[model samples]
Target: MTDHHPDPAAPQPGAAAPQSACPADWDPLASQRRPEDPPLDVLLSGTVFFDIVFTGLDRLPEPGEELWSKGLGSSPGGIANLAVAAARLGLRTGLVAGFGDDAYADWMWHTMSEEEGIDLSASKRFPDFHSALTCSIAAQGDRAMVTHGHDSPEPMSRLVQHAPAARAAVVDLAGETDWWGRFTSGDTKVFADIGFDETGRWDPADLAPLAHCHAFTPNAVEAMNYTRTESPDRAVRAIAELVPLAVVTDGVDGSYAIDQTTGEEAFCPAVPVTAIDTTGAGDVFAAALVLGTLAEWPLEQRLKFGSLCSALAVQQFGGSLAAPGWGDIVDWWGSLSTAAQAGDLRAGYTRGPYMFLDDIVPDHPVQGRRRAQGTFAMRSDAGHH
Candidate 1:
């Protein structure tokens, strides 16, 4: 069997790698196709909780100034949102993380174990730690967040010790890095999503353990931070050196991917849509990409599915609330594709108008517009600063 390898050196943009029309003798697909449903076992192994979002009508008040909320509510957040999105897409999902001994934790567990199809057997209950939460101020559908909580790191040995059947593990790097080394040594496919906190940012060094990951999905800012590069193309190139596949999402600017196996890069243009709330757009994209890959869809199709899912997420406030199920996404994709063909480029779909406590703020600026469109662009415009 011949080993598949990618060029270690960077290829000039637009330069094509040599192509092979036929599969090698040792290609995994050399055997006959199996007639079984694609395995749905996926572990969303990381932070879990509800986000307590508070949105205001205008810019946040000065330190001593009091302000009223336009809206407020609690919803699933962090890896919990990712897991729910995966479950909604028909994956047999599980979560491996810690939750507090608070009412929010109860809500989180019930939602995962009862309302959703996720297995919560591995979740550790901590009595002292606060359940993760995020508070946001909304202006014209865009939001600024203030979040708190510490994600307890689960040991890789403990995770592997449970030994449930799974095809892949989605790691949200909000926990300890040591477990990463152990997690990646197994044969299961590995994918990672980055998270940030108030006093710290996700360090690229933490990703070194996942040197041969099946895929790395990072929004443009995270990608730039990982690569230490100013240019998006350069960041993509740098990340390809560490992982087999790297996807860099730049909001409305679209997304790009580098195939480590072939040293080929593909671009997925963002589906043009008006967005209401921009939360959870990246998580939705990650879940959709995983589903598409599991379905063996082509690379471009996988990105298209992911991008469409993200578009739907921004149409509403909060992360998980805005996520569309697989069926809804398929329908939306069909409509978008048809619209694209007809040159009605601006027609798109969104998922939410869900009410929140913060929506009560008097004179709030986001009353009628979607936030995802311009907010992410503005937030990421600095490109990793």
Candidate 2:
């Protein structure tokens, strides 16, 4: 596809490359579609935030002090992060959430439905309400966020009287359970994650939702806290007893998984990269893991794919926009392969983890995709930055 985001101020090369007018779509589950299957591959529901990220900050401003940032990006965040990640990877994603009748809401609605191809049929827009907004500061290898907004007038559980059928649903364990029962009933699989417990209760009873879930993905700290285990490996194993599949993500070191349903256990190392911003890396990882699960890939392969996707996401800024498309994956693999062939030992070692993509990625050239505008500036005004 033609770059949706073009840098006009940059000097043009002597010979510009031809752009793809018609971006080719690569559906990883194209072979599995049936006439009776659900129209949506994945269903998601949560709050949507208009995220403004400030990067290149030496540090956050001190009290009553001011600082300048070198970079800025704007995009839809929260549930939109997972939605964009899944949609970019070719999943027929449907989102159910609340929105406001404001400019931020308008931009986000357009970006997700028109640009990202996410279905918003089940979502609603409330007049007179302001959309949630978050300002994030990235510095010193981590980020901090300040948000402002009220809860949706209507809870998602109440808004979703009847959840539509889907192959899979991604949900948080802390949400209401009334609507979840109807959605998790038949062939639909539920993948659950949990938020940090601010109360420090770390109570196992809070995780009762796992009884109905097919898989659970949690960070290493979350797993250890809930399972009372000291290490990620033990935490995953403990969690596997509750859900058929358990995945614990350990930043930098990688991820660990235990799939009791398939009788498999494995660990996948993280792909090393200089992270520019890590806004929605977990959402990307969850999306990739869901894709692998639906495609019936082995446990280890799924972890590796998820880790690779997360790695790519952290290299960019815009939370939802940072999600990588198939073209990004293909380009990354091609570049690594070329480097390895040219005697780059590091590329060779790094490529060994994703060798499985050889059989899965499409052989034909597909469109390359990246994040949208770094800022919400008009196209003609973008060059000023």
Candidate 3:
């Protein structure tokens, strides 16, 4: 793994410097819209956590040693990572999760519903429940986290019952949630993901939910262990037998995917970028894949898009908020194309792989999107307390 961290002298919150303002809004799906289509593009339900991320750590502290991290950030995490990622990519996203009445919950609610423009019509606020919180120690492109929170007072089935209809939904098969069946019944395509099995059992029954899913995305290790395959290629093929679309993401090596729906299989290489923090790179990848799939793009392009988005995400710090918007995509492509034209060998190879993006990215100017903040203070509450 690449050993890299943010510069210690950088800003405290989010660790990275402030990003430029991105376009207020841009809908990539406008061209494919139909009058009868669902109001939301993606539906998600899970716990939302107030994440406190510490970056620039040289190493984990020894038992008796104390270490001061050079960077810090605060944002909504857990399911919110996927939610913000999809929304930033111009998907009309809705979230069904429980929230608390505390300050942390209030900040996350404002960030997701107001700042991020995610739909929270189905989410509920408990009277005194405290919002979930995670403290992430980031170093060497990976992280260790300590989280404190409780399960939603109400079952996810209860919250999802009121969720808006959508074209697709992202489900964690590990959650063993029963609501995806209801979604599939309504013609919503389900994209499933599985969490690491700490039990090491790697039981096949854990994947029973794939029967209702349109696609399944798992990391290389998880896929290999679950399928008992020797390699990601074999794992993806085996997984495809269970779900129409099987995606195995190998960090830095890129992603491999097989789409039985399109009779296409492809491997997209990871875009090389200096590592900062890889907190939510996987979520970013899944969001990009969902966008490409919903748009009816070719399977190869879908993998490539997902790889590129995740690459962009890891170049920054934080999780949910670090996800790139279209403006970020535009900037990355523009820089690459310029470098390629100027005879940069590596840039040429990278730009050529994503040549498909030439036709899809917006040609006109677009605003830069929101960046991760160090604090949860909302402008509306400013000067009031």
Q: Can you write out model 1's per-residue Cα lDDT over 1-385, one digit (the tens) per residue?
A: 0122222321121121111111111111213224452233477666665676665467666789878877665567777778766765555566767777777777666545544446665556767777877666777666667878774644543653453545677775555544445446666677876654445555667776557578888778877876778977788788787788788889898888887765567787786677766777888888777766665656666676678778877766666645655334445545555675676735422222111101211221111111112122111111121
Clashes of each: 15, 0, 6
Question: lDDT rank, highest first?
Answer: 3, 2, 1
Q: In candidate 2, how many Å is residue 124 off?
A: 0.5
Model 2, stretches more than 4 Å misplaced? 1-24, 370-374, 377-385
Best candidate per lDDT, number?
3
lDDT of each candidate versus the true structure: 0.59, 0.81, 0.82
The 10-residue segment with the lowest total lDDT in model 2: 13-22
Q: Write down the worst ten-residue block by lDDT for model 3.
A: 13-22
Q: Compared with the true structure, what per-residue lDDT tens digits does model 3 show for residues 1-385?
A: 1112212221221111112111125678888989889878899999999999999998877689879999888889999999989987888888888999899988888777765667788888999799999999887756788989998888889878887789999999888477667887668889999989999999998888788889999999999999999999999999999999999999988789999988999998887788798888999999999999999999999988988889888887878978887778888889989999999998898788789889888886554555565676764321121
Q: Could you tell me the lDDT of residue 5 within candidate 2?
A: 42
Where does candidate 3 clash, by residue pair?
21-368, 22-367, 22-368, 22-369, 23-367, 23-368
Error of 3 at 128 (Å): 0.6
Q: Please provide, for model 2 over 223-317, each residue's C-alpha lDDT reduced to its tens digit, 9 standing for 90 to 100.
A: 99999999999999999999999999998989999998889999988998999988889999999999999999999999999999999899888
Q: After TM-score superposition, what is the CA distance of residue 280 in candidate 3 from its true location, in Å? A: 0.8
Rate residue 108 of model 2 by lDDT: 81
TM-score of each predicted structure versus truth: 0.70, 0.91, 0.91
Task: List candidate 1 stretches off by more than 4 Å.
Answer: 1-40, 126-130, 140-142, 148-160, 180-183, 195-206, 262-264, 330-385
